[model samples]
Each structure stands twice: as structure tokens, then as C-alpha cells.
Target chain A: MASPKILIIGGGPAGLSAAQDITDAGGEAILVEQEGFLGGTPKRLHYSLLAPDLKPVEEVLDPLIDSVQQSGARCMTGAKVESVNSGRNGFTVTISGGGKKVEEKVDAVVVATGFAHWDPHKKYEYAYGVYPDVIDFKDFEKMLSDGNIVRPSNGQVPRRVAWLLCVGSRDRQVGKFYCCRLGCAVSIKQAMEVRRINPAIDTYVYYMDIRTYGFWEDKLYWKSMEEFGVKYIRGRIGSINRGEDGRLIAMAEDTILQRPSEVPLDMVVLATGMEASEGTRETAAMLGLELEEHGFVKPLESDSMPVSTAVPGVFVCGTATGPKAIPDSITEGSAAAIKALNYVRKRSIKVQARA
Target chain B: MPIHEKNLIEKEDLLEKEKAVVDGVDVSGRWNTFIRERLLSDYHEDFVEEVKSLPGGRTVTNCWQCGTCTSGCCLHTDYGLREFNPRYFIYLAQIGNVDELKKYGDVIWRCISCNKCVERCPKGVKVEEVVHNIDEVLRRRGVTEDTPGSRWDRTYLDNIMATGVLDELGLTLKYVRAEKPEDFTRGFMARMAVKIIRNGNIRTGPIRRRTRGWKKMKKVAEDILERDGYASAK
Candidate 1:
């Protein structure tokens, strides 16, 4: 049998890892990315550090990008998977970008189309568009990458800073009810970075829950409190208004203290959550893949068979499924590759039979 | 606002060992005070379902316990009250902790219906109404005795019914006599009998009474005593 040709959608860490693994295992892989660059959100957003360890982004992301670029798999940057049609024995997928289209026949398809950072503008109460200082995590990370923490309005080091958690995710108003999963840990990490930059800055994190889950609980959440003196307030901000002093005024009820507080700060960072990317939604719809309430692609079985989809010869993984951290996405990428490879190897045993 | 400077958890929930020997090591003092696990025997599974049926309590099930209601609660923010938390009570109600709910009956009715909680609740939980429902549940179950507040209300209504006139002196006498004020001689004098029997200071537990208005006078007493010493307090 000719080695199976596998089509991987996306060119991020997940797609890169999927392509790398399939190529290493002697399977022909075709990786497609919508963006011209291979690196995904991290490169786009210029993320400085990965939390829990606070390791430099380059340390983790650069190597994966390099390996996939150098691998036997055919990498197609600035390309998109236009359509997927399941034929008699395999899938015929249409790839198009830059006004050119190519048709390819593949034994399996892996949808690693990752998520998008939720648009903070959906929450008008925060006044993100109005105030230059009220920035979201994407802007905040870019500022961090620039290596100077300053108020966007004045270009001076801020005396006071605040982070508003649960911006778009876990909110009914925005029709997003799932936890973004990365909001707490990332905000805590960012807060720690701010404190290291300037200890005098009165840093506060307004939150519903400091859900720095698993191993990150101690390293990110508690350490940010105990080590960095980052104040964690048990309340979400009700609103943000411009003060006469050019400071941003945040109104919130301090649930722990059971007191209403109006704190004025030079900079306000909104811990924005994630949602299914437009590409992810389009790909899921195009490929006839099931989607969850949050618009992320739903696997055939979430726990037992995570990578396989309802459509035979198609697999889904990473943040394409739901809100996930970087490492988990990479791990899912490899898992999806193995599942796709297995499906190709057992061409006689149809996954449709199991369905 | 009542300044509750103590915790009922320490008295009621915490179980301490005098000298705890944990795996051949003396993990006594701070480590010894372990919170005893609660029993589900007092848990009424249908209580939450029943509470949701009441008026203004339809949104009782909608609380995600984000603490938004309690955060903006006037009784807490303006009054500096740590107890009477909407989040705390809602959580307790969800888990069917009827025993715990009964203990807070006195102050559960203290909600002034500011609706700050209702306005700001992200989950659309009508918090003030839920609080009212909790108070109603406690009152209907007869778990708490007729509080002094209810007794006063009853006394005032009865005065109106009996004479249909506002007689302040008559109302005061009727209310006071019904309560039956006991003269225990004096403050220190009352404790003299127990102190003499013990031949030392009596080790009574904390008298955790909700000192509402008297707390203001107590602050004044504390300031004067701190500056002038216990002699001035005498």
C-alpha cells in the first residue's frame, strides 16, 4: 500500500507538530495555514512568555516551527482548506489562497484550526475602544514584548495598574459560557511581570475566581499574591470610566471584604478570553464536522476518542475543540497525527462502522 | 451595620487537639485546628427546589456565586458587615446545608433590598429576592424562634389593634414587660458568684452576640480605656 497522504489544517504549534509527527512516521503530510507566517497567535500577538514556567516563547515555539519547516511534510503557508468531500475510499480536499486553488486526495484530514482571542470590544461597558489606556491581553502582551510597561495614553510608567478577568468568556451577555481556561494563569503571569518591572505600581487583579488550575495554582496564582504582592480582589469590575486625573476608574464590589470600591489606575488590562476562530468555524462547517455550543469543533467522543470526528477519515484536536493551553494543544496535535495514521493503515476497517 | 469581629466556625466547626501527634511529629497549635467534615443528615435536598417556587425567588437557581451581589451589597459595603453574604448563603442553599442556613436566620432578613446585587449579577440572579426567600424559608420552617425584631413588630401591631393610638409610653411598657427585663444585680457583681466558686477567672466561651448600636459605645469605651487604662473603664 502507498504510504497514506494526510492533510493537516492550520500551521500553528498543533498543526506543525501533527505534520512533523506524521512525516517522522513515514506518512505523507500536507500542512495548510491561512496566514503567510507558520507561527500562529504567539507570533501574531508577540507573546513574551508561556506561564506556569514563564519560559521564553522562542524557547518552545521557534523549535516546533523550524522542525515542521525542515521536515519531509509539504508545508503550505498562505493557504486555506476550502472544502472537504468524503469520497468512496478517501477525502478530496480543495486548498485555495492567493487566488490559486489546488485539489488533493488524502486518506485522512486533521483539523487543528486553533481559536481566536475573543474581541474585547464586544463588552462595551469596559470602554476599551474609548480609552487608550484600557487595553486587552493582546495589546498588553505586545507591550510586554516591546520590553517597556507604560500607559498607552501618556507613554509614562503607570503608578497603578489593574486586570479585569472574564472579559468575553464565561459571560452570558456575549453568548460565551465556557471558561477561556488560560485567562487566570496568563493574567497572573502578566501581573508578576508588571510587579518585577516596577514594585511600586499598585497592581490589582479583579476576578470572579483565580482559577490558576492544576500545577499552575501555586506557581502562577499563589506566587503572584505571596511573592509579587499582586492584590487579588474577589470581584469582577462593573464598569470602567475616565477620571478627571486622566486615570481609569474601575468600579467593583470587593466580595471578600464585602465592600464597594472605586479604584483609579493609570493602566487597565482586560484578561480577554478565547473563541473559535473564523477559520475554525468555516473549516468545521465546510468539512461537515460537529461543533459544540462555544463554536469549537466537537470530536466524536470527547474523552475516549478525542481526535476522531463524526465524519470518518477526519480528526480534530487542540484549541479547535475548545479553550486549551499551548502545551495541551501540541500534545493533541501528536495524538491526532497517530489517530489519522492508524485510520490510514486500517483502510479496510472503516471508522464509519464504529459510528 | 453590625461589626461581627468573631467567627462561629472556630467555635462550631473547628476541632482542635491539645497536642496532636501526627506520624511521630508534634503538629500541635495552629496545625491542630482541623475543620471537622460536615454531615449531610441536616441537608434538605428539596429545599432549593422549594425556595425557587416562592415569589421573587424564581432566579434563586441562577446564582453562580460570583460574589457580585455580596460585593455591591449595601449592608456589607456601607455597614462593614462581613456576615450576611449573598454568595455564601446561595452556595449553602445549593448544597442543601439547612443546618448552616438556620444559624444565619437572624441577619438574613437584614437585606435592605438595595438591588445592587440584582443589577450587577452577571448570571441574572435576583439576589435581594433570593435573600428574602431564604429569610422566608427560615421563618416558615420555624427553625428560629420569634426574634426580638418580630416581637417588636407584633407588639406595635397589637397596640394599634387594641387602642388605634400611638402611645409611646404604653407601647414601651407593654413591649418591655412582655420581654421581662431581669436585673442580675450588676455586671461584675453578677459574675462574682461564678468567680468565687472557681476561685479564679471563669473560662467562659465568647459571648458572640450581635452588638449593633452598642458597638459604637464599645469603640468609645475601648479608646478611653486604651488611653486612660482599665482604671478609667472601672
Candidate 2:
């Protein structure tokens, strides 16, 4: 019998992992990414370090990219899924790239289209775009990678830096009511990194809650405070403005003390959250897949079949299903691949019986 | 309902109808409690800039209210004067909440200028100067009356202007006579005076002495006070 061909949307961690799984299981997999490169946000944003363990991001991502490359999966970069049509037998996915259109028929599809970083500018009070020194987590990651963690206004080393948590998440005003699960851990990790780089640089983290979730992350949160001496202020910043000297001034009520406080920082990092990627929405719409309230593809049963979507042969993993960390995304990707492989195999068996 | 809403509930704004019925409805439970809307239109918008203009207060606008100042405050800790919150008063002064600041006027003058808050301030806010500036602004605005500390300040300055040196005994007696007449009788001040007498730091009889550059020093100090808009410059 011929191997079942599967089309995996999004060339991110989840999509790459799913392709790896399908290809290893004797199935031909075609992976499509919108950007010109693979590795998704972790690569695009230059995330140098991962949370909980402080492992180099390359340690996790390099192997995944190598697997996707070595597995002989047809990897198409700079390609976008223009349309997806479901037929009696399978799916016809039309991908557009570099002024060329390619049509491919696949037995099953894995929609691992990941999430977009929530734009901090949506919450204008943070003065993210207005102030040069007020940056989001992606920009902070880039700064860390590039070793340019200086005030953009004057190119001076920031003596005091503050990380504001939940810039675009857990706030109904910005329409993001879900916690971007990794935001807290990522901020703690980044703050610790900043202290490690320069212990003289004063670091403060303003948060509603340090929602590190699990035990390992909880330890990391404490380590950030106890070991690194990174100050934790229990308050979401009310507003941020540029000081006269070009420093970013963040105003927040220290809820623990029940006092309104303002700190003039050389730089302010807004720990932005994750939202459904535009591609995720477009793919869901084209495939007639059910989207959750937040625009992620709704799984057939979240409690059991998290990888199975409403659309029969189309599955979702990683942030396509919702906001998740890299490890969780990889796990879901493999799970979705197994479900897709089973569906293709079962359908082929039925086709043979009919014949 | 929401946590943010819970934060918006100030103790003063909380209204509880203990036993009440409205239009045949017994709206007397926890649901009946209402938080008054906070409307802040009376803000002195340039208050932060105003405080920043004073000497040693250039970084008043730099405070991020980390409670470092309050935590390191000698008045707040040693004296256990919880109301002597340097962080809270700095916030009030920055926002120009004069009415709210008046509530803290009695304790604002208690800042010992120990410079501990200054040393501990991560943002480099001259907390001691900012506290004094707040007191100065409040006194200038007539929001608060002259506190015992303010009376002591006046006596200290007057002694310096007159003698070009601090007349410790004269200033202390004058300040106590004006502010705490009961203390003038020999409790804390009397015990200190006895110690000074035993240490040979006090003259038993009237002795004639003058500061060599009294006139020049007085003129310079008066000019500075006048330029800084102090009412006692004359």
C-alpha cells in the first residue's frame, strides 16, 4: 500500500515536530511555513534561553529543525496556504510562494499554525510604541541575543530596568482574557538573565500574579527573587511615560503596600502574551474548522482528544490549539501526528474493503 | 467581582447598608455595598515638576514607589509611626493630592532626614529632600498648619541668620516655648540642659560673643532664602 501523504501547516516547532513524527512513521509529510525560515517564534525572535532550566534555546530548537530537515519531509518556506478544499477522499491544499502556486493532495492535515505575540501597543498606557525604551518581550529577547541591552533613546546602559507583566494578556480591555502560560516564566528567566549579565543593573518585575504554574517554574520564580535579587512588585503598571531625561517612567500601585508608586527606569520591558496567529484563523476558516473564542482551532474534545479538530482529517497542535510552551507544543504535535496517521490508515483500510 | 475592581475599592469609598429595604427589596447584604466612583479632577498637574524644582528634589519625579523609602525610613520603623510613610506622601505630593496630603501633614514632618531612604532608593530619589519639599509645598499652600517641626525649623533658621551659627540652647528653648510650652518646664529639654551644663558646653552667665562674618553670612543666607521664595526671607 502507498504511504499516506500528510500536509502540515505552519513550519513552527509544532508543525516541524508533527512532520518529524509522520515522516518517521513511513508517511510522506509536506511542511509549509509563512516566513522565509523555520523554528517559528523562537528563531524569529532570537529566544536565546528557555525557561525553568535556563537551557539554551538552540539546544531544543536545533535538533527539531535537524529532524525536520533530515526526515526527508518536503519543507516549503515562504509559502502560505491560499486555500484548503475538503473532498470525499482527502484535502487539496493550495500553497502560494515566490509568485508560484502549488497544489497538493494529502490524506490528512495537521494545522499546527502557532500563535502571534500579543502586541503591547494594544494597551497604549504602556507607551510601548510611543517610548523608544519601552519594549516588549520579543524586543528584549533580541536585545539579549544581540548584546545591545541599552537605552534606545541615548544608547546608555540602563541602571534600572522594570519588566511589566500581562501587558496584553489577562486583560479584557485588550480582548485577551487567557493567561499566556509561559509569560511569567519567560519574564522571570529574562530578568534573571539580565541580573546574570550585570548584577549592578537593578531589575524589578511588576506582576498581578507570578503564575509560574508548575513546581519547576515556581522554583525559578523564587530563584529570580532570592538568588538573583530581582525585585518583585505585586502590581500591574497603570501607565508608562517618558521621563524628561528620556527614561521610561512606570506608574503602578504597589498593591502589597497599597501605595501608588512610580519608578523611572532606563528601560521598561512589557511581558506580552500570545494570541492566535492570523494564519491560524485563515487556515481554520478555509478548512471549515471550528475556532475557539480566542480564534485557536477548537479540538474535538479538549479533555481527551486535544489533537482532533471538528474537521475529520484536519488536526491541531501547539498554540494552534491554544497558548502553550515549546515542550507542550512539541508533545501536542506528536499526538496530532499519531491521530492523523491513524485516520489515514483507517480510511485506507476502508477504501481497500470497498474495492 | 473582578480583582481589579477589588483594588479600586478604597476603605473610604466602601458604603454598606447594614439594614435597609429599597422599594420592597431588602438590599442589605454584601451585594448592597457600593464603592463610590473615584473622580480626580483637582490634581495639581505640574505638582511633580513643582517638587522637582526644589533643591535636592530634582529626582522627585524619579520615584517608582517601591516602598524602599518607607521600608528604610527611621520614622516609620524606629518610631513605629506607620503614618510616616515617605512613599505614600511622595505619591501624594507628585499627584498634587493636597487634600489627601493634609491627612499626612502631622507625620510628614517626622522624617528624620536620616538619608537611609536615600541610600536604599533604587531610583536615586532624594527621599529626604522630597519629604521636605512636600512639607514646604503643603505649608505654602496653607493646606496644613505650622507643625512643631516647622516651628523648630524657623527657630533654627532664625538663630543661624542672627548669629551665623546655631545657638543650640536658645533655639531649643524658643522652639519649645512656642510649640511645646509644657516640655519647656524641664522634662526632656531640662535633662538635656543639665547634661550640657555638666559637659561645660553652656555659659552660666551672660557672655558677649559675636560671629566674625555675621553680617556677610546673614546677607548671603537672606539672599538665598529670598531667591528661594521663603516667607521668612525678610
Candidate 3:
């Protein structure tokens, strides 16, 4: 029997990992990335470090990028899956990119299209777009990567900085009820980075909860407070205004003290939550895959089979399924790849038995 | 203990008689002990707005009652004055529970104005100022009587107004005489004064000439105070 072909949409960490797994399992894999680059949000945002251990992001991503390159998986960057159609034997996926359309037959499909950061502007209380100093996590990561962590309004090293967590998640006003899982850890990591850059720089994290749930991540959260002295204030900010010095002034009731407090900060970093990417929604619709309320492709059963989608030959993984950290996404990527490979192997075995 | 855990049963609110009879039924001891049931029907819905109008009370509406201010407060941490919860007081003031707020009159003055609560408050509630604002509201509503803290505050302000600078020795003497006469020459105050005198920082005669432009400065201060509806020049 011919090598069973599997189409893995999204050339992100999940898609690349899945593709590498499929090729290793002796199944032909086709990885399609909509962007010109292979790496997804992390690469696009220039995330310099990973959380929990503060390892360089390149240490994790570089190997996956290299694996996808050397695994002989047919990789297509700048390609979009315009549509997908089910046939009697398998599935046909049409790709549109480079001013041309190409069609391919794959026995199975894996959707690994990840998420987009929630736009901080939607939460007007933060004065995100209106105030130059108010930036989102992605922008802060980029600024850190570029070594230009200064006030955007005046390019001065900010002495006082604040991180406002739950900018969009767990906010009923914004219609996002789910907690963006990685936000807390990411904020702590970034705050630690701020201290590393300048110990004199005062960093604060204003949060409803410090939800670094796992034991290791919880330790990192403590390290951020005890070692780095990143002050954690338990209150969600209500309003932000510009100070006379062009500093951002945040107003909130210090819930602990039950009194209104205002602090002048050089910059305010909104730890914006993750939302389903446009591609995830589009792909789910085109493939006729079930999507959860938040629009990520729904798994067959979240507990029992997280990587399997409702569709027989289709699988889902990573942030494309829901908000997850990089490690979980990679693990889900491999899980989805195994599911897809099994589907392909079963189909091939059936064909052989019929022959 | 958090402010919520504060003992609401005050001595004045308790009615206990060693021997008593009610409606020809013998009631005595435990049976005669009747503790007042605290009920709050008066909600100052606009109390939060009133406090917000004050200089440091503008952010009272932003408080979600998280208690971060109390946990981060230096006074609460160092002294564990559970009754000195800034957060709970803000809640009471926001809801306009004046009766409940009156109960906190004593420890409310214990705030040292360290601004740790201010620095750590995520909501930027201007905690120190909010505490002041709460006190101001209490003073206006006659919920709190003039305590030594308020007396000392008046003395300090009067000294500053008169001399355009803090007259530490004069203010201390006046404060001691007016507020705590018994402690005027006892304990910490006496020891500190002797140390100062020995250190030669204490001047013997009348205070040096008033700060430069004392008259002009006092006039400006009085004008502002009068405009703000505060008694000008005491």
C-alpha cells in the first residue's frame, strides 16, 4: 500500500511537532503554514524566553524547526487551506498561496492553528491604545527581545511598571469566561525579566489571582515575589489615566485594604488573554469540525480523547483546541499526530484486507 | 483577624443584669443578658460618591473588597491591628454604613500613613488619602468625637500656619497639655525630650524668627482654607 498522506494545517509548534511525528511513524505528512514563516505566535512576537524554567524560547523552537526541515515532511509556508472535502476513501484539501491553487489527497487531517492574543483595546478601562505607555504582553515581549523596554511615549527607562492580569479572560463584560491559562506564569516570567534587566526598576503585578497552578510554576511565581520582589497586588484595575509626566496612572480599590488606590506607573502591561485565531475558526468551518463556544475546534471528548475531533479522520491539538501553554500544545501536537497516523494505518489495513 | 471578624458585641450594646424579672417571669443571670442585634437599614448609597469627592477618596468605587490593602499594610503586618482594616472601612464608607463606621473610630487613627497599602493596592485606591477621607466624612457626620490624634493634628496645623514651619517643641508641649496631660512628663515622651535636650537640638528661648514671609504664607494658607470651607487661622 502507498504511504498514507496526512495534512497538518498550521506550521506552528503544534503543526511542526505533529508533522515530525507523522513522518517518523512512516506516514507522509504535508504541513501548511499561512504565514511566510513556520514558527507561530512565539516567533512572530519574538518571545525570547519560556516560562517555568526561563529557558530560551529558541532552545525549544529551533529543534522543532530543524526537525520539520529534516523529517522529509512536505512543508508549505505561505499556504492557506482554502477548503476541504470528504471523499469515499479519504479527504481532499485545496491550498491557496503564491498566486496559485494546489490540491492534495490526505487520509487524515490535523488542525493545529493556534490562538491570537486578545486585543487590549477592547478593554477600554486600561486605556491600552489611547495611552502610549499601555501595551499588551506580546508587545512587551517584543520590547524585551529588542532590548528597548522603555516608555513608548518618551523612550525612557521606566522606573515603575505594572502588569494588569486578566485583561480579557474571566471577564463577563468582555464575554470571555475561561481563564487564559498561561497568562499568570507568563506575567511572572516577564516580571522576572524586568528585574533582570534592571533591579532598580520596580515591577508590580495586579491580579485577581496568582494562578500558577502546577507545583513548579507556583514556585516560579514565589521566586518572582521573594527573589525578584515583583509586588503582587490583588486587585483588577478599573481605570487608567495619563499623569502630568506622561506616566500612566492606574486606579483600583486595593481589595486587600478595601480602599481606592492610584499608582503612577511608567508603563502598564496588560496581560491580555488568548482567543481562538481567525484561521482556527475558518478551518473548523471549512472542514465541518465542531468548535467550542469560544470558537476553537472542539475535541471528541476533552478528558478521554483530547486530540480527536468530531470528524472521523480529523484531529485537533494545541491552542487550536483551547488556551494552553507551549509544552501542553507540543504534547497535544504529538497526540494528534498519533491519532492521525492510527487513522491512516487502519484505513490502509482495511484496504489491504479488501484487496 | 480580618476586619470582618471584629467583635461587634460592644459593652454599651450589651444589657446584662445580675437579677431581673420580665412580665412577672423570673429572668436573671444568663437569661437577663440581652445583646443588641446589629441591623443595618440605612445604606448610604451616595456615601461612596461623597467619599470619592474628597481629595483621596476618588477611587473608592474601584475597590472590589479584595483585602490586598490590609494584607500589604505595614500597620496590619507589624502590629496585627485587625480592627485597623483599611479595606473593610472603605467597604463600610462606600456603602454608607455610618453606624458601623463609627465603631472603627479608635483604630482608624492608628494609620501611620506609611503608604505601603497605597504602593501595594492594585486599584491605586490612594489608601492613605482614602483613610483620611473616611475620617473627614466621620468628622462631618459627627460619627467620631475629637480624639487626641485629631487634637494633635489641629495643633500641628496651627503651628505650621503661625510660624510657616513645624514648631516641634511648642507643638509637642501644647499637644501633651491638651491631649494627654498625664503623659506630659512621663514614659517615651519624657525620655525622648531629655535625649533631645542632651543632644543640644533643643533651643532654650523663644523660637527663632518666624520663617521668611511668614505673614504672606499664612495669608495664602488662610485664603485657601477659607475658600475650602475650613476655619481659617483656627
TM-scores, all models, native as reference = 0.61, 0.63, 0.64
lDDT of 1 by residue, A122-169 (tens): 899999989999999999999998889999898999987889999998
Could you give candidate 3's per-residue lDDT for residues B1-234 as a string of tens digits?
Answer: 233633546778788898889899988887787766454322344566667666566766556567899998877878887778898888777656687788899878778888888888776678888887788778867778877667767788888887786767888778877767664566778798889889988764364447897777788889887765457765
Q: What is the DockQ of candidate 2?
A: 0.02
Candidate 2 chain B weakest lDDT stretch, 10 residues: B37-46
Tally clashing residue pairs in candidate 2: 3
lDDT assessment of candidate 2? 0.82
- Sorting all predicted structures by lDDT, with the top scorer first, yields 3, 2, 1
In CAPRI terms, model 2 is classed as: incorrect
Give the residue spans of candidate 2 off by over 4 A.
Answer: B1-234
Error of 3 at A21 (Å): 0.6
Please tell me which model should have the higher TM-score, number 2 or number 3: 3
Best by the TM-score measure: 3
Candidate 1 vs 2: which has more TM-score:
2
Q: What are the candidates' individual DockQ scores?
A: 0.02, 0.02, 0.02
- Cα deviation at B187, candidate 2, in Å, is 31
**Candidate 2 backbone collisions, by pair:** A262-B63, A262-B64, A263-B64
